[model samples]
Target: MNEQLEFVVRAAAIGTGATAVMDLWGLFLKRTLAIPPLDYAWVGRWIGHFPRGRFAHANIAQAPRIRGETPVGWVAHYTIGIVFAALLMAVWGLDWARDPTLLPALVVGMSTVVAPFFIMQPAFGAGIAASKTHNPSTARLRGLITHLSFGVGLYAAALFSAHLFPI
Candidate 1:
């Protein structure tokens, strides 16, 4: 395989594996922690409403419960993983996929929290940088921890895939 195509393959593999890990994590969190599953479909619906500005800057946390759905949010969540994988490939090349590094990936994932803090949360009415809650600092810290965990997930997935399906 050509270098470029190989890179794409590696990136796709990493992205897929990382997304799977995240999905499993969500399920585990729901089941073990008793955190209600966030209906990703509802998140998607909210995304659909973006064009109309119906959900624009709407406080999602305060929104009345509607089966606890959010398809757009789920889509966004997975898409972010895909995008992050692509970025990792772009910056580090296929070798990174084969021999994933936890630190760099963790840094990248943790840094990504800024987006949800500044953009998504506020748009969904959570408040700027998680300001809506009684303890905004705790919320922000949780988000950072979650994203860092995602980074670890990404690295673990890549390593597992590389071993299971050697390139």
Candidate 2:
């Protein structure tokens, strides 16, 4: 495969794998600790209104439901994962993907917290980093753990890919 095509494929796989790991972690948290997972429908609802210049909501749950909100949110979630993976590749390069390091993946994953802290949470009416939510600390911890898991996922995916396509 061409260099660009290979990179694209690797990035997609890494992101998808990372997202899957995050989802699995979410499921574990939900099942073991009774922690609830994020509502993607709300995310969709928030995004759905962006075209209407309605970025902030007092309560996304109460926001008017939008058509195909669930699908939109899910797609956006996965796409964001891809973007993060691409970011990791951009910073660390294909050599890292082949060798599989932990720090860069973790850093990129943890850095992704900025997205929710500044944009997503605030727009969804949860305040920055879910400050306005029922339990801010708990919410923050959950996010931190989730993001960390995504970082591990990124590394794991890289290792797995390298094994599969060893030079």
Candidate whose lDDT is highest: 2
lDDT per residue (tens digit) for residues 87-146 in model 1: 876777777777778876777677778877887777777788879867899778767766
| lDDT at position 110, candidate 2 | 93
After TM-score superposition, what is the CA distance of residue 150 in candidate 1 from its true location, in Å? 0.8
The global C-alpha lDDT for each of the candidates, from Candidate 1 onward, is 0.70, 0.90
Please give, for residues 1-167, the per-residue lDDT of candidate 2 as tens digits.
Answer: 77788788889999999998998999998999898889888888888999999999998999999999999999989999988998899889988887888999999989988898889999888999999989999889889989999999999988998898775
Please list the residue runs of candidate 1 whose C-alpha ends up more than 4 Å from where it truly belongs after superposition.
53-55, 61-73, 164-167
lDDT of 1 at 165: 54
Q: How accurate is candidate 1 locally (lDDT)?
A: 0.70
TM-score of 1: 0.79
Clashing pairs in 2: none
